[model samples]
Target: MTETLRARLARVGQSYAPHEHRPLAGYVAAMGAFGALAASLAAAAKVTGKPAPERPSLGDVALLSIATHKLSRLIAKDSVTSPLRAPFTRYTEPAGAAELNEEVRDHHSSLKHGIGELITCPFCLAVWVATGLTGGLVLAPRLTRLAATALTATAVSDFLQMAYDISKHAAEGD
Candidate 1:
C-alpha cells in the first residue's frame, strides 16, 4: 500500500531545510529561548550585582515567539493541506481525495505566505538582532532603560505591522 500525501508532507517537517540554511521554525524558537534566557540573566544580574553578559530581552522573546508560532503554523498548514489537492487525490484508493487535497492546498498556500511574511524582510531581522544588542547594553546602567524601552517598542510595533502586511499578501495569494 502506498503512503498518503499528507503523510509524505508531514514527514517533510521543517527537515527539508538545506544543511546551510537556517530552519525558520528552529531559528524562531532559538530566538525565543535566547530572549527568555537573557531576560532571566538580566533580572539575575540586577539582583546579584554580577555583571550581566550580553543577552536578549522580554520584547525579543515576544517577537521571537510570534515568529515561531507563524512558522509552526506554516508547517502544519502545508503538511495538512497538500494531501487534499489534486494529483495527490488521484492516488487515493476507493474514493477520491479531492476534498482533502483542496483543503491541504489552501492551508499550505496560507502557510507559505506566512513564512514569507515572517522572514522575507532583512530589516526586521536586523532590528531584532540590534534590539538584542541594545537590551544587553541596558545593563550598563548608563545606557538607561529608556533607550531600551524605545527600541523594544519599535521592534514590537514594526514586526506587528510587517506581520499584518504578510497576512495581507498571503490572503491575496502573493
Candidate 2:
C-alpha cells in the first residue's frame, strides 16, 4: 500500500510539532513574498526608466517609518477591520488598560494561522507596509508623500487625543 499525499503531509507537519514551527514557516513565506514583490517592483521601475533616487532623505525615511507604524497599528487593532479579521482571529475579553480588545489567532490551519499572526501583529505588518510606502515613494513621489503626510498627521492626532484623555482623567481624580 502506498502512503497518500495527505498522509505524507501529515507526517511532515508532525515532525514540526508543538505548533512553534508554523510561525517560522509563515515568516519564511512572508519574506519570500516580500522579496518577490521587491524584485517585481524593481523590474517595473527599470522597464519604465524611472530613476531611483540617489538617496532617500533622512526626513523621508522618518516620515515613512512613522506612517507605516501608524497604519499597521490601525489595520491590526482598529474596530474598522474587525469584520475582516473576525474569521482569522479569536476575540478575548480586554484586560486592564487595554485600548483595543484582544484578538488572537484561531490557529485553524498553518496558512490561516500565519495570516492571522501577520494581520494581528503590527511589527510584522510594518515591514510590508513600509515596503509598499517606499515603493510608492519611488514610483510616485508626490502621491506617496501626500498619503504619508495624512497618515502621519493622523498619528499626531491620536497622540493628542490620548494625552487629552489622560489629562481629563487626572483632573477628575484631583
Candidate 3:
C-alpha cells in the first residue's frame, strides 16, 4: 500500500499540531515576493533613468499613508470587494449576536489560506499597498498624487458620514 499525497500532507500538518507555523511560513513567502517586486521596480527605474528621490516629502508620505489605510480597509471589508474575496473566504453571521459579520478563510490549501489571510487583514495588506503607492510616487508622481487625493477624499467622506449618522442617532435619543 502506498501513502497518498493528501494523507502525507495531513500527517505533516498533524505533526505541526496547532499549525502556527503555517501562517509564519506564508508571511515569510509574502515578504520574499514583496522584496523581489521592490527590487524589480528599482531596476526598472534605473533602466528608465529615473533617479530615486533623496527623501520623500512629508506631504507625499502623509497622502500615501492615508490612502493605504483606506485602500486596505476597502479591500478587506467593503461589500464591493466581496466578489473578489468570495472565492478565498466565507462570510459568517452569528445567530442573535450583536457582533459584526465576519469573513474567514476557507483554507483549502496553504497558498489559498495565506492569500485569504493577507486579503482579510488590513494591517497585513497595508504594507503591500503602501509599497505600491510609494513606488507609484517615484515612478509617476502626478498620477500617484491624483489617485491618492481621491482615496484621501473618500476616507474623509467616510468619516464625515459616520459622524453624521452618530449625531443623528444622538439627536433622536434626545
Candidate 4:
C-alpha cells in the first residue's frame, strides 16, 4: 500500500498541478463515463430486484468498508501532513494515515481538482457501488445492508473530519 502511493505521487509529478489545463472535454468525458456507470447500476437494479453489484459482493463487505476508510484519509489529506501528524507519523514509518492524508492533500492541491477530485469521485463512487452490489447478491442477504451501514458510519466520521477541516480553515481564514 505504502509503495503504491509513493509510486503514484512520484510518477505523476509534473502533470498533477492544481490548476493545470487538461481539456475541459476530457473532464466532461470522464463525468459522462461516471454517469453512465451510475445509470447502469440503477437500470440493473430495476431489472434485478437486487442491489446493484455496486463495488463489492456478499463475501467482501469488509473489503469495501476498507475503501471507505481510504476515501476518508484522502479527504483528510491536509491535516495528515500537519505538524500534529508528527507524533504518530514517525512511528508509522514510510507514511502513516496522517501522511496518507497529506498525500491526498498534496494531490488535490497539486492537481486542478476542477469540481474536485474527478479521480476521487470514482473512488467515492466505488464505496457505494460496492455496497449496492453486495446488497443484492444471493449468499448473504444481510451482507449488503451491513456494508451500507458501515459505509454510513464511515461517512459520519469523514464528515466530522471535514468539519474539523472547516474549523481549521476557518481559523486560518480569520
Candidate 5:
C-alpha cells in the first residue's frame, strides 16, 4: 500500500511539475508532522488540565520574538551545531560571527532534500521554533520564560559585542 501510494504521488508530482524535482511528498509529510505535533500539545494541555492563556502579553511576545530569532539562527547556522545538520547539508564557507554557510545536499530521496532545505534555512526553522516555544509557554510558562529570557540576553550581548568591535576598529583606524 505504501509503495502504491508513493507511485501515485510520484505520478501526480510529475504531472504538476514535469521539469522540477519538487518534493511535494516530503512537504505533505512535514505538514502532517507539524499537525500531529500541534494536536499532541493540545492533548497534553487537556490531560494536564491546563488552560491556554487568553492572549499573550506584549512583553512575552517581544521576548519570544528575539528568542526565536536567536535560536533559529543558532540551530540553522551556528558552526557548533553543524554536526546536527551535517547529514542534510554540505559545508560551503564561513559565514562570519561564528556562523557557517551550508548548502542543502542533493539526495536521491526528494524527502531528504526537502528536510535538508528546512534545516539549513534559519527563516524556515523559525516557524518550527516559534511553534515549540509557543507550546512550551502553555505547557510550562515559567521554564519557557526563563529560557526565552536567556536567549534574549544572549542576542543582546551579541549585538553589543559587534558594536564594540566596530568602535575599536574605528579608533584604530584613526
Candidate 6:
C-alpha cells in the first residue's frame, strides 16, 4: 500500500515538475512526522497533568525568537555541526567565520533528498526549532528560558564581534 501511494505521488510530482525532483511524497512524510510530534507533545502534557499556559509572555517570545535563529543557523550551517548534515549534503566551501557552504546530495531515495534539504537550510529548519522551543516553554519554562538566554547572548556576541572587526578595518584604512 505504501509503495502504491509512493508511486502515485511520484507520478504527480513528475507531472508537476518534469525537469526537477519535487519529492512530494517525502515532503508529505516530513509533514506527517511534524504533526505526530506536536500531537505526542500535547498528549504527554495531558497525561502528565501539566497545563499549557494561557498565553506566553512577550519577553519569552522575544528570547525564543533570537534563540531559534541562532540554533537554526548552528544546526544548518555551522562547521562544527556539519557532521549532522554530512550524510545529506556535500561540503562546498566555508560560508563564513564558522559556517559552511553545502549542496544537498542527490540520491535515488526522495526521502533522503527531502531530509537533506531540510537539514541544510536554516530558514527551513527554523520552523522545527521554534516549535521545539515553544513546546519547551510549556513543559519546562525555567530550563527553556535559561537555554534561550544563553543562545541569545551568543548571538549578540557574534554581532558585536563583527561590528568590532568592521570598526578596526575602518580605522586601519584611515
Cα TM-score per model? 0.24, 0.81, 0.81, 0.35, 0.92, 0.96
Candidate 1 per-residue C-alpha lDDT over 49-74 given as tens digits, one digit per residue, 9 for 90 to 100: 75654575675555444443333332
Task: Name the top lDDT candidate.
Answer: 6
Error (Å) of candidate 1 at residue 144 is 8.8
Please identify model 3 stretches exceeding 4 Å from their true place.
1-21, 94-101
lDDT of the candidates, in the order given: 0.45, 0.77, 0.76, 0.48, 0.90, 0.90
| Highest TM-score model number | 6
Angstrom error of the Cα, residue 25, model 2: value is 4.1
**Across residues 106-150, which tens digit of lDDT does each residue of candidate 2 receive?**
564555667787888889889889988988888888999999999
Q: Ranking under lDDT, best-scoring first?
A: 6, 5, 2, 3, 4, 1
Clash count, predicted structure 6: 0
Report the lDDT tens digits of candidate 4 across residue range 1-174: 255653565456436654553333334445666677667666766776655344544445555565455444443333433453332222223343244332222223222332234333445445445534443443344674565466666667767987898899999995
* Alpha-carbon runs more than 4 Å astray in model 4: 1-20, 50-116, 120-141, 152-174
**Backbone collision count in every prediction?**
7, 0, 0, 14, 0, 0
How do the residues 1-174 of candidate 6 rate in per-residue lDDT, one tens digit apiece? 299999999999999999998878878888998898888878888887889888888999899999999999999999999999999899999987799999989888888888998998999999998998888887888999999999999999989999998999999995
State the weakest 10-residue window (summed lDDT) of model 1. Answer: 97-106
Candidate 2 TM-score, true structure as reference = 0.81
What is the lDDT for 94 in model 2?
49
User: By the TM-score metric, which is better: model 1 or model 5?
Assistant: 5
Error of 2 at 33 (Å): 1.8
Clash pairs, candidate 2, are none
Among residues 3 or more apart in sequence or in different chains, the pairs in candidate 5 whose N, CA or C atoms overlap within 3 Å are none
Model 2, C-alpha of 37: deviation from truth (Å): 1.8
lDDT (Cα) of model 5: 0.90
